[model samples]
Target: MTKITFVQQDGVRIDTEAENGSTVMETAIMNGVPGIVAECGGACTCATCHVYVDNDWTEKVGGPSMMEEDMLDFAFDVKEASRLSCQIKVKDEFDGLVVHVPGRQG
Candidate 1:
């Protein structure tokens, strides 16, 4: 399992053990990380699961795909590091990955 961290808007950090092949949104929901409202599940149809990839892990996490980018247009407070958590698949390399939850969802 990979370790992932979700930092809430108020600076609460939720650490989770993520199974490989599962998306970040899934892990957050499973672990009850607030601010990750995956309205469309993992279908990439909504930006409710939006999160900002920590600067230190951005390159490793990579940018959002074209489709994900499009969906992110509806996300609240979109930033250069913004990504749909559902689009981020967990992997061993993602251990210690950190993402920040926005103040609200779109």
Candidate 2:
């Protein structure tokens, strides 16, 4: 398992464990982490699972797929580091991944 930290807009930090190959959204929802609605349940259809990865880990996490990039356009406070959590598959390399959740989701 790998640990990932999710930081909400209000500075609230949520830490959770995830098994390799699971999506980040799955880990968050399973652990009851706030700020990620995951309305589409990792289907890549809803943009509610938007998150901004820490700058240092951006390259490590890689860029989002074209579909995810398109969905991110509907997310709140989109940034260069923005990503749909559902599109990020957890792995040992992401052990310390830190992502910031924006204030809104819709």
Candidate 3:
């Protein structure tokens, strides 16, 4: 399992393990990590699962796909670091990924 960290809007950091093949948003929901609404589940249709991948891990986590990039337009506080969590699959390489949740949804 890959360990992921979710930094909530209020500065709370929640750490949990995500099984391989699961998405980052799914891990957050399973762990009760706040700020990841995932309204459209993992369909990549919405941006409620938006997150800011920590600068240090961005390269490793990779960028949004063409579809995810389009969906990100609906996210709040879109940044160079922004990503749709549902699009990020948990892999062994993502053992220590860190993501920050926005203060509010778009």
Q: Which candidate is the best by lDDT?
A: 1
* lDDT of the candidates, in the order given: 0.94, 0.92, 0.90
> Compared with the true structure, what per-residue lDDT tens digits does model 1 show for residues 1-106?
8999999888889989999999999999999998888989889998999999999999999998999999998988899999999999999999999999999998
Model 2 Cα lDDT, one tens digit per residue, 1-106? 8999999888989989999999999999999988899999999998999999999899999999999999988888899999999999999999999999888997
Candidate with maximal TM-score: 1
Best-to-worst order by TM-score is: 1, 2, 3
What are the runs in model 1 whose C-alpha is more than 4 Å off?
none
Which regions of candidate 3 are displaced past 4 Å?
none
TM-score, prediction 2: 0.96
lDDT score for residue 91 of model 2: 91
> What TM-score would every model get versus the actual structure?
0.98, 0.96, 0.96
Q: Candidate 3, 51: how far from true, in Å?
A: 0.1
Clash pairs (backbone) in predicted model 2: none
Candidate 2 shows a clash count of: 0
Q: In model 2, which regions exceed 4 Å deviation?
A: none
